[model samples]
Target: MAAAAVSSAKRSLRAELKQRLRALSAEERLRQSHLLTQKVIAHSQYQNSKRISIFLSMQDEIDTEEIIKDIFKQGKICFIPRYRFQSNHMDMVKLASPEEISSLPKTSWNIHQPGEGDVREEALSTESQREKETWLLITKWLRNETEEGVKTWQAQPLLLKCQSN
Candidate 1:
């Protein structure tokens, strides 16, 4: 009974949040995305790493276009996700350049990812001292298998949080 109630509450919360997101003006959404992108770029996690992984944003989410471009611009290695819906598996595959992003195929979920057969070096399989992810709507700092912490500016998408994060 408790589990059922918890699930119901979760669903309700998700619905309410999504409705609120939909209510946001397009201009406001874009402005927030731009600010968050700048914050991620200026983040120390981004500055020191040679290789980085990030998500391709959805329409309703914070845009990552600038961040991805900046990765290539700074001459750092970039990795994007390739998800397998059939199983609980996701790989961070190396991306060649910013231009290649558009050519990649889009999944049914409307996310762009490399083709199944397209072989790219998996971040974990490589020998790297640091691996980090700047998520679609959140920025996380990870150290190997253990999570160091997740910092999400999306939770409170405001100009005030931008300076601190």
Candidate 2:
């Protein structure tokens, strides 16, 4: 009974906090979001690794350009996720330039994407949806594995759309 009460109180507190945060103004939300992202990057555990694999967050609209650039600056190799329709998951690809990933297309729930291409060119958008702006990426870790002829270390799968055959 004591544990149950504690859990109930915690849930109530959490709900109240969520409600208050949701009531924040759009500008305030953006500011808070930026700060949170900065904090996460600052305290990230993978900072000095030789390679880092980051499965980009789909739900969050945080821009990873600066972070990607920073990774390159550290002389680390990074990778992002590419969705394959033939298989039901994402395939990892090494990133060459931070500026190359111009825009990420929403291909699935919480999954936005920028494909591998030349660093000087931008990824063309094939969709008209405005809410689909965030892109999912997978960074390289210490090593890579060749599974079934595809490369991966630790990354997730499909976003929404399948790769064109």
Candidate 3:
């Protein structure tokens, strides 16, 4: 009963926050998103990382397009999660350019995801074993795995958080 209640409360909070985010004006959203991107780009972890795993932003979330562009410009590899419905798993797909993203089909959720024929690649490769590779993650909120063991950055006051692990 206690667990159920906690879960319900969390769902309610998430819904409310989502509503608030959806209500923001386009200009406000763009401005805030740019600021968030700048903050993430300036972070030492992002500066030093060779590979980054990032999510495609939903309509109400902070936009990641600029960040992705910057990553490519810096010659860093980018990975995005591709959900496989049958196996109920996600595979990281390499995105070489922003144009590649636009060319992909959108999922039912309206987010662009790698479909069949997209070149699948591993975020960590054999070469990465020799050197300690840094990782950066940008998201609206921090999760348990990220919070406990990873270095995370939160873009607070704006209500969206970007994590660098």
What ordering of candidates by TM-score runs from best to worst?
3, 1, 2
Tens-place lDDT per residue, model 1, 20-66, is 56766788678777777777777766676667777787887667899
**How much does candidate 3 score in TM-score?**
0.71
lDDT scores of the candidates, listed in order? 0.69, 0.48, 0.71
The local lDDT score (0 to 100) that residue 65 gets in candidate 1 is 90
Candidate 3 overall lDDT versus native = 0.71
What local lDDT does model 1 show for residue 104? Answer: 96
Q: After superposition, how far is residue 2 of candidate 1 from its true place, in Å?
A: 11
Write the residue-wise lDDT of candidate 3 on 1-165 in tens digits: 698898899999989878767766788678778878887788777887777777788877888888889989999888887887778677656787888988889887787898866666655543543354536474554323364585433343221222322
Leading candidate by TM-score: 3
Candidate 2: worst-modelled 10 consecutive residues by lDDT = 155-164
**Model 3, residue 151: C-alpha shift (Å):** 27
Q: Give per-residue CA lDDT, model 2, range 21-55, as digits (tens).
A: 45656565456446544543564344434444445
Candidate 2 has an lDDT of 0.48
RMSD vs true structure, all candidates:
10.1, 16.7, 8.3
